[model samples]
Target chain A: MDQALPELNNPPKTRRGARTVRKLLDAAQEEFGSKGFHEASVAGITSAAGTAQGTFYIYFASKEELFRTLVFDLGRRLRDFLTENVDETTDRLTAEAQGMEAFIRFVRLYPDLYRIVLEAQFVDPEAFRLYFQDFGAAYRARCEAAATRGEIRVQDADAESWALMGISLFLGLRYGIWEAERDPGPVVASVMDMIANGLKPRPGEGGTA
Target chain B: MDQALPELNNPPKTRRGARTVRKLLDAAQEEFGSKGFHEASVAGITSAAGTAQGTFYIYFASKEELFRTLVFDLGRRLRDFLTENVDETTDRLTAEAQGMEAFIRFVRLYPDLYRIVLEAQFVDPEAFRLYFQDFGAAYRARCEAAATRGEIRVQDADAESWALMGISLFLGLRYGIWEAERDPGPVVASVMDMIANGLKPRPGEGGTA
Candidate 1:
């Protein structure tokens, strides 16, 4: 799979080479995030990175390759961030709430996260699919472990993971990007409430506003 | 607002003109859906409609204009489909379940729905925002109504709406588009269970498999 993906086949062997690659990826994110994939150019990314035009080619074969690499890099970074923030020992519901809050904060810092991922659907369908699939797989594993430990109710981890992912993604889009003014505390609490107690009115509990 | 959108400013005055516009929009869907916005051509849309190239300009000013129009049109059509399919009388939980099931079914039929909507986030940010905003607003209204009637627990409708939308959209992307081989019934039931009962095991209810 790495061989099939030319972008991943070439890896920086030295510290200096890795620094250059990191700079290029950061510049590519800003370039692609602002101007989009179609309007973004190799020259623009190179200039933004303050690297020689030839330096970019040494790291990436083409602009398409760079974009795909950047996408993969972003997903890995995001997963790392989520993993570090969410405690594996916590119950599934607690983990979900913390994970959601962390995701929203991440999106707030990287406002271009959604734009770049969404653009991948058109510019690089395979990357877009892989990004989500990889995230879903990790999420499903965690859910399954939690279920086995009786930290959460027994359920289909596959479906549950996808549904939970949808909740976080949409919430990030709405509160993290679109309406940045709204407090995420209430939003997270409300969602976690539904995730914990559900929307059903408990017996003998009046639905009071 | 319609007047503000140049693409939507021009209205077909006669029944024949309206029919022609509809035909062009339908053809544009196929063209844009298959070829994407940048690669999709005016000639291809017209040809697909079985109409002369000049006739396209009568309805749309340019290919960009037509693409924007098509994105807006698809949103409206999808909103209409969800509205007509989701029974308003049902409680919020039931409505959510039915709506998710219907949306998945809709995507199965119109597999391009996610691609087009996701693409609009990059190609046309305003259209993409409006598409979600419009749906979120309507969803919030229903949620607010359900809360008032004591059918569901009281919560922040705005936040709830976005979360619910995220669930449906992501599920549609996962089950409807990527893993079409899987039955959506199980997916819908799993998600609905989460929404209704949540992940927390009830008191005295052993976490039985």
Candidate 2:
């Protein structure tokens, strides 16, 4: 309980107040997700939360603050979600396959996640940069750890981290956001094939070589 | 000049007029790149181009139209840039390495390119969608051709194209935009190594296995 949460920099003092803040966030997500940050109003958020407008001001100063807060909050939520979704298997390649598929599924579930994040570039470029920077930093650490444990090959884990994140991101943009309307199972499998085995055609693996 | 160009859908009739259009576009790039779409003004663009305010209306209907056009125009330029930079080498790996390094360099040179493209998502979602969609389709065709020619492995070229694009994109973001203050040579080299050899540790590689 004593642990400081940056997402909630202005911590709610009471347990009931914490719950109210949670309610506001949930309502804010849907509101901004549907209406976007520019069109989304604090009044709309409070209304959605079933709280009075004054109550909204009690916790936050303006809509801008809430949107930025929601970005970090969503970022944390996504990190936790992916960690939970990835298989517990020791093999990094296998985990990547599960992790990417799970990421796409997350985008589908949280349709507004991309919209909100993308809009952050326009609203607050710093927040947008930090979002990816934090994610990339954490991911790089994991890749390095996995490389040490021999779960993955020895490689430039920093570039690999960004590269892998890029793969998941574009796939999410295509399949999850664009409503690709195609089965991701084969798509993910194909990506895993490239990730697990290099793109160079092997002699016995259906290659003319 | 007879051939139609979508970015300049409203083509200037004479060579002189065409030059003016080019000037406006180039100036717009700097303007939007510096000011962003929302903050950017048509007057600012005209001022940058050294054209009269009335001349601005000769080609573009509004600032919005110019921004959209700039997005597509930039997309074309990037495609040309990457195509020109990728080596004539037959090996897919060689081409990829050359292509990725070139892509990163392009980002460094055209610092506003990513910002303009990202802003397109907010200004015109359809344009942003088409920008990547068109790129993915072209990239997929090339991947399939490379696979058929045995230049690369045969996998899901569709997913592979998106994955590759994602890699170049995020790398561009990290190295080009964020001012990493590090040479991209090593970053891109590491990615090339991963692309050439899978992440799995091999006997000869420095892995303890």
Q: List, residue by residue over B1-209, the lDDT tens digit for candidate 1.
A: 12122245688777777777778877877888888888988888889888899887877789877877877767766777888898877788888888999899888888765678878887878988988888889888888888777888857777877888999999988888888888898879888898888888777765534
- What's each prediction's clash count? 0, 0
Pairs of residues at least 3 apart in sequence or in different chains that clash in candidate 2: none
What DockQ does each candidate score versus the true complex, computed on alpha carbons? 0.67, 0.55
Q: Indicate the worst ten consecutive residues by lDDT in candidate 2 chain A.
A: A1-10
Candidate-wise lDDT, in order: 0.81, 0.81
> Model 2, range A48-162, lDDT digits (tens) per residue?
8888998888788888888889899878778788889987555778888888998899899888877788789778889999999899898888777777777777467878889
Residues B15-86, candidate 2, lDDT per residue (tens digit)?
878878888888888988887786888888898888998988989898988888889888888888887888
- Minimum summed lDDT over a 10-residue window in model 1 chain B is located at B1-10
Q: Which 10 residues in a row give candidate 2 chain B its minimum summed lDDT? A: B1-10
TM-score of each: 0.92, 0.91
True contacts kept of each: 0.73, 0.64
Query: Residue B171 of model 1: what lDDT?
Result: 90
